[model samples]
Each structure stands twice: as C-alpha cells, then as structure tokens.
Target: MKKKVQILSILFLGISQVAFSQIKEEKLILDRKREPEVKKIEKKKTSVTAEKNYPPKEKKTQDSLNLKYNITDVPAASDFKTSTIQGEDISPKFNADYQNNYFQLGMGNFGKILADGNISTTLENQIEVGADLHFLSTNGLKKEYNWDSSQSSANIGAYLNAFGEKGKFNINADFGLNDYNYYGIYALTPAADIDLQQKTNRFKVNGYYDFYSNNILNDVRLKSSILTDKFDAKEAQAELLVNLSKHGVEIPMDEVTMNADLGINLETINSEFSLLNDNTSNYFNATLSPKLTFFKGKSYLMVGSGFSFLNGKNNSNLLTEEAKNNKTYWFPKAEVQIAAADEFKFYGGVDGGLKLNSYANLLEENPYLVSDQELRPTETKYKFYFGIRGDVDQSIKYDVSAGFAKMNDILFFKANSLFNNDFSLNRSPYNFANTFSAAYDNGTVSEVKGSIQYFPLANLVLDGELSFAKYNLDNNENIYNKPLVVASLGGKYSLLGKKLNLGAKAIFSTDKTTNSFSFTEAGTTPNVYLETEDKNDKIGGFADLNLSAEYKVHKNFSIFALGNNLLNTNYQTFKGYKVLGAQFLGGVKISF
Candidate 1:
C-alpha cells in the first residue's frame, strides 16, 4: 500500500510540473508578443517629448508651389459707348497718299502780303532734307502814323541716321535767316527820318550716339550753334551731354538714371558808332543730375546741381560805372513726382539758373532797344513751384500751379530819355524815333497759372488758360510793361466729316502802367520828366478776337481764311507801338 500511494503522489507531482511548464511556456510566448507593442508605446512617448521641444517643418502649399500669370486683352472700339461725352481722337490723322511739299499764299488789308513754302524729302541711307521759306509784310492803317513792317525768314535742315551692330548715330544740321523791321515805333515820332531794319542768321549742328550696352554709359549728345544779328552781335554755343543708366545694378527701387551736361557759350558785339564799343562774353556751365524711381516708377525724385562761370567785358558809354566782369553761381535743381491716384499726379520742383542776357536775345524780344545799352546776365536765385495735374474724366484734363521766383537784374522796358540825345553829335542816342531802353530791377515775382482742356465730342475741343502775377520790386518803382492778368479762350470744331474746320480765339489783358517821359525845352538842352497825365493815354488795355476757318476742297488742296483783331481796338503793346486793327487774310494751300 505504501508503494501504491507513493506512485500516485509522484504522478500527481509530475502532472503539476507538466502544467507549470506549460503555463511558463505560454507566459513566455505572450511576453514575446507584447514586446513590440511595449517598445512602440515607449517610442511614441519619446517622439511626443521631442515634438514638444522643437517644431516640425511646414509642408509647402499647392498654391505656393505653382506660378501665376496675368493676361489682358484689348477691348474693341465697338465695345465703347458713343456719345457727346466720349473722348476725342487726339491722335494725328494723316492722308497716306498726300504729297509732302506744300505752298501757301495770301493777301490781307493794310497792304499785307503773305507767302509760305515748304518741301521735305527722304533719301537713301536714311537721310532726310527739308527747307521752308516765309514772307510777310503789312503797310500801316489809314492813320497819320506811317507804320510799315515786313518779315522774311528761311530755314533749311538735314538729318542722317546711321545704325550698326554697336549702336545708332544721328546727325543733324540746320540753317536759318530772319529779317524784320521795327516799324511800330513810328508812332512816337512820325516825322523823324529813321531806318528800322534788323536781321538774324543762325546755324546749328548736332550729333547723338546711343550705345547698345548694359553698362552705365549709354548715350552721348553733342550740339553747337552760331547766331548773329544785324547789329554785329554774334553768339556761339556748344553743349555736350552724357547719359548713364544703372539698369543692370540690382536695387530695391525701380530705376536710376543720371545725366551730365557741359556747355560753353561765347558772345561778341561790335559797333562802328562811337556811342557803342566792342565787347565779349564767355560762359561755362556744368551740371549733374540723378533720378531715382520707386514703387515701380509710380514715384520719382530728381536731384541736381549746376555750376556756372561767366567772364565778360562790358564796354558801353551809357554806363557811368563798369559792370561786373566775372561772376560765379551755384544753382540747385530738384523735382518730385508722386502718383496719388491712377489718373492724378502731384508734382513740385525748385530750379534756378543764370540767364545770359545777350544783345541778340534782347533785340529779338524788343527790336527798338537802344544800341548803346549795356548787356548783363540775369541771375535767378531760385524758383519754387508746385502743382497738380490730372484727368478729371475720360475727356477732360486740368493743370493748376503756383510759382515764386527771386531774380536779380530783371530787365524791363523804359522809354528812352531825350536828355542824352544830341542830333548833331550822333544820330539821336535812341534806337529809333520810338525807342526803348532796357532797365533792370531786382525783385521777387509770384504767379498763379491754370489751364484746362475738354473734349466734349470726338471732333471738338475746348481749352482755356488764365494767369495772374504780382511783382515785389526791391526799389519803390512800379513794375513796368508787365501784364498783371492774362487770359485766353479758344475752341475748335470739325464739321462735314472733318472736311471743314473752324476755330476761334479770344485774348484779354489787364491794363499796365508805365512811366512815360516827355522832353521840356530848357536852356541849351532838353530836360526829361515823367508824364503823369499822359501815362494812360497810349497804354490802355485791349481785348482781341480772332477767327480761322479751313475748308478742304480736295485731298491735296485746302482754302483757309483768318481774321485778326476783329474788334478794331487800337491798343499799344509798347509805350508808343500800336498793333494792327481789323484785318483779314485768305489763302490756298497746295500739297504736292
């Protein structure tokens, strides 16, 4: 019995051992299965911790990965509405089959005659040649004054263009002659026997070259001119300009451009009369300008400065003391432009320079200048101006501006005094029977000007301009021969399919007061004093009306007529000068 019991215990113990073994094996298998999951969880926890410490890189968006392009299509003309408010076609209209040469002739009242001719042609090798001639003359009205005037002018020009792989070159030359008479001055002394004739001849030659390069130096220009007048006054001027563009240089702004200008001017005056002496003047100027554009060229600023040197000798018997022989000036130039809106722009600038007052220049504006007058340069210290210009709508535009200028040696017109005239010693110290002498004053001039243009229809245009000025002279003397208020209104219309064109213009000016002098018989001499009552006698304000009409009879022929000073108002532009009254001119133009 003991052996049997022992065997049973052994069996039981063996069974238990087997069951324990199985359990152990299953636990080992389960642990093996869970090992990967445990490691994955631990890895996930680590990844979360790392993510808290550092941010991951962002993924690129689809829109950012793709490029975009903008396209625009021009609208057809038919798409636009047609009405009187539509914008006019301002582009020049040409007859492709028309001829280039033209001639015009006309005659008017007051024994006036007019002739004009022009011819132009293009040759081989890109050469062009042209010539023009004009002549006009008018006899005095049916008044006691014997005013007769004539003008003849001619011009010839040539241009040549040469192109190569490097760049292009342009050469041009021009020659011109002008002849006129100072006839309006006869009203001052109708009985005085005098010859009033003046002539001017001018020649100019210029060349320009553009280099095809990405470098800063891109172009160069050279110009030279010679001008001479009947009074033996001669002038020569030469100019050089170099343009630089920094297009290749990368900048935050849009563009940068620079210009360098160099100029030389020479003038000489010679007279055989003892009252006038020989003189010579020389001037040299250098300027540097640079412009910067920002906001894709919507805004710009240009800064510049110039240096001028003048060397001259004034030899005139009329002056008690000699004028300045040498002078130097530094002038500033600056301008700013901002595009506040799509169609509106704001612009302002400050600029100034020395204006060379030469004998020929003065004579052109006032032909009755006294021959013995001294010539000097006018110094403009500064001119400050600001304005806004923009299109009010599709068919209207406007510009308004205000400016102030400080000037030294501003020239004005004054009647020549009879005190210095000795008929026996000289041929009357005056320029003519009715002569004016240049008077200078230092002052500040302020002006306001505005202009507007409207195109109410496709074939009609209306425009007007108005200006007002005030002068504050350094001395107590009043501003002479200056128009304080000036205004003009004009309109043009095309009828019958543009076959007939009509235009009208009206001009008005405010009265200006100037000191008039009268000679008083004195002992052995004549004394001159300002005439107080007669100051307004001959210097009254006047308004003028003008009309012009043209009818195109054919493609190559047109008839035109012009009427000037229709009001027949006898107003004096100068102290003793009176312009023509009502006059009419009719002419025919032949194009071939």
Candidate 2:
C-alpha cells in the first residue's frame, strides 16, 4: 500500500508541475497583447493631460515577475503670436478736371475791347444760380469814317434753375446797352446833320418750365422784353408759348407709335416813335397749332394745321392804310417721310406761318434805320417742299431740298434819300441817304438748298451749305438787298492730345440790288418834286474767311486768337456800310 501511494504522489507532483508551466506561458502571452492597447491609451491620455489637471494614476505590477510600469504628464505649449498683413494706400488719378467758372478779356485793333465772365454754383436742395457779364466795344475806324463810327455793347444776366423730382424750372433776366454811330453816306456826296450817337437800352426776362412726369403737358415758356432807343423809339413785347405732347399711343395698328402735339403762342407788341410825333402802334397775335404723327419702322407722317389771329392799330401817318386791317390766317403743316433703303429717305412737306415784323426786329436786321418806319406782318401764304436725305456712310450725312413759297407784305430795305438829293449839308439829321426804310411787296420765291456734314474723327468736324434762290416781286423792280446765291464752309480740328484746336470758316454771297431814286424839281412850288428816274444799284458780292486757334497751356488755362476777314477784302455788309478789312483778336482764358 505504501509503494502504491508513493507512485500516485509522484504522478501528482509531475502533473502539478506541468500545469504551472502552462499557466506561466499563458500569462506572458496576455501581457504582450495588452502592451499595445496600454500604450495607445497612455498616448491619448498624455495628449489631454496638458488641458486638464488629473490626479496621479495607480502603478501596476506582475505578481510572479515583479515588473512595473509608469506614465508621465505632459506640459502645456507656449502661447502663439498672431500678426496682421498691411498694404499701401492708393488714390485715384484723372487726366483733366472740370471747372464751373470762366473769365476772359481781350483787346484788338480798331480800339476793340471785349470782356466776358461767368460764375455758377450749386447749393443744397437741387438749386443752381449763375451770373454772367459780356461787353464789347470799338472806338471806331477813324480812317473809314470822317466822324465817329464807334459801337459798344454790354450785357449782364443772371439765371436760376431749380430741379425737381420730375421737372425743372428756369428763370433768366438780362439787361443790355448798345451805343452805335451811323456814318453811312451816298456815293456822290455826304449830307445831313443828325445826332450820330444812338443809344439803345434793352431789358428782358425769360422763364421756362419743362416737365418729365410722363404726361401730356410738356413745357412752357414766357418771355418779355423792353427796348428804348436814343431817338425815343420805344418797344415792349411779351410772348407766351406752351407745348403739349403725348407719345407712344397706338393709332392705326400694333407696334405703330402715334404722337399728338399741341402748341399755343400768344404775343403782344407796343411801340411809340418820337420821330413820327409819338405815333403809337400796337399789335396782338394768337396762334394755335395742333399736329398728329404716326411712326412706323423708321418712317413717319405728320398732319397739322395752324390758325392765327392778328389785330393791330397804327396811328402813324406812314403806315395808315395798310395797318388798319385785322386779318385771320390759316396755315397747313403737313409732312411725310418714307425710308427707301437703309441709307436713303424721301420727304415732302407743306408749311406756312405769319412772321411779325417789329421795330426791334428791323433794327436788328439793319441798325441804321429811320425811327418812323412802316411796320407790317409778313404772311407766308404757302410753302411746298420735297427733299431727299441720306447718310453717305457712318461718318457723313447729306440733305438736299427744293422749295417754292408765296409771301405777302415781304419787307425790303431801301435807301431813304430824304434830304440828300440836293446835297444840303444843313438839312435835318438822319437825311444823308444813309438810313434805310421798310418797303413792302408781294413776292414768290423758289429755292434749292443742300447741306452736308462730315465727322471723320472724334475731334474733327466739317460742314458745308449751299443755296440758290430766285425771287419775283410784284411792286419792286428787283429783290432789294437779298442774296441769290449763298455758300458757307466750316471746319474744326483738334490735335496734340486735344491741347490745340484750330477752326476755319469761309462764306460767299452773290450780289444784291438796291433801288436808287432821283428827283427833279418840276413844279414851281417850293416843296413840289417829281421823280425823274428809278435805277437799280448793284452791290458787289463778297467772300469772307475766318480762322481761329486755341492752345491749352494747362487744363484750366488757355490762349486764343481769332483772325476775321482774313482775306482782307474791303467788303460792304450793307448797301452803304463797309466792314473792317481784317480783324485780329488775341486773349487768354482762365477757369476755376
């Protein structure tokens, strides 16, 4: 029994030893597998250790091998430094600057003086105010006239503009003073001892309103003027004009634009002539015009009519019978335009109107006029015209037209040889046959005219016009002081980066005819006279050339020069008055 027990014990001892060895190997394998996982957890914990404050971790050890492991905490990183990027500042540049004010002064031969200035400013509330002054004077051409032929003119004006949301209003007032001397004489002799100095004063006020409210009411204008001359010739005029229009209305078909327009004009003129024993002439005119236009594909047709009512009273003995009539005028205003091609067009029209002739208007046409003159209204009975217009190219355009007109009471300027027929030096003033008087005649006129414009470059422009006319007068032998042929050519060019500008113009006019009357004392009476002969005096044609130049020293400063009548021809602008041979003016301009 003892021996059996010993064998079992030996077997148990061997089995126990084998089991312990197997367990030890398994523990080593488990530790190797957990090492990687433990390292990963330690790295994750170390990353967050700087952000959080944690208590110390417990140490771990293997029982049989007595192995230990430890983990260390990490330190926080230093604060990072931040900065911003910076760049250089830049400003805008421009080639030129705009100015709102200008001033100019000049002097030339013939004792000429000129001055012009303007100032404008914009205040708050869309309001603008401006003022301007202009003056020109000449001390006379002593060589041409034995007496003083000096002339002077001065003007001062102010304007105000108020802009609204949908409209604008403008008001302007101006005053003018003109001093002139009439030194015209007949070819045979000089006579009359009249007051040579004539002074004229003018004052005017103009008001305009333009609407942009997208309605039928378009614009309105009111103008008034007062004029007084040295001879006690006074005139007062007032005019009112109103325009109404509506566009984009379909009349006959779709996509066709129809426009309706109406215009009304009212004017009154009053005059008093001291030379005619305070003879007073008063006139009032009212005109109403209405038009309708239809536009379709670059072609348009307009049909309209005008009605005019005229009433006047004249107590002047010179205009007694003709001025005592009241008349009503009917005018036709019609036009048709057809586009034949992209570049060509055909047009026809008929128009007529009444032209008011006043003392002020006659003075403007011929300054050396007698104060006691006949005043009448010109009636354009009918004017019919047909024309062809086209564009030659993108840079050129042309227009040609032919027209025929019948007119009544057309005014003509004729020499008034009041006291010069006998060459009397001690006669009344303004009797040297140098002054002009109004002559009326019924006439028919036929004319052909053409115009062309060329714009080859942005800074260059050229234009030309030519016209020929034939006049047949009923009561006059020939058309007085009217040109049969007229032509003009003009051009402007800029060079040197737009710093230099040059311009030129040429004008040519055909000869004019003026009637010369001779009287012979036939009766035995002291003042009785009989007309002997009436002859036509011919005034030769003339050509005028003008040149101008301007050089910009700076953007705000410039020097200019003008050469007028460059041909130096001694030409007569009127029947007896001759213009200066050549004129030169140089000056500098400044702007701010």
Q: What is the per-residue lDDT of model 1 for residues 1-592, given as tens digits with 9 covering 90 to 100?
A: 3353354345434533443443222321222211111111010010111112122221112111111110011111111011000111111112212333777777777666666665666577644455545555565543735534545555556555554455557777777676655555432353434456666787888888766552466678887777776666667767677866544233554354332223333333322223344444455544444443222344556666656666656545455765546667787787777768635778898988876665556655666665545556788899999988765444556678899999999887776544333333233324444566677889999999987765455444556678999988897356777788987665555556667766655666787767665433345545422222234333666666666677789978888877676666666777766666777778887878
Best by TM-score: 2
Candidate 1 residues lying further than 4 Å off, grouped into runs, are 1-99, 142-144, 147-180, 184-194, 203-231, 247-250, 253-280, 290-297, 317-327, 422-433, 523-538
User: Can you give the lDDT of residue 144 in candidate 2?
Assistant: 65
Give the backbone clash total of model 2. 1
What tens-digit string does per-residue lDDT give for candidate 2 at 1-592?
Answer: 3353354345434533443343222321222212211111111010111112111121111111111111111111111000000000000001122234777777777676767777787789867788877787776556766765678888888888776665667888889887876666644344333456667899988988766532578789998999998888889999999988776666768657777889999999988888843567788999999998887765788899999999988776554353465889999999988878535888899999998888888876677787776677889999999888765444556678999999999888887766434423555446655678888999999999988765445445556779999989897779788889988666555566767766656667888888665555555655544444345788877766666677789978888776666566666656667766667777887877
Total clashing residue pairs per candidate?
A: 0, 1
Q: Which prediction has the highest lDDT against the true structure? A: 2
For every candidate in turn, the CA RMSD to the true structure comes to 31.8, 37.5
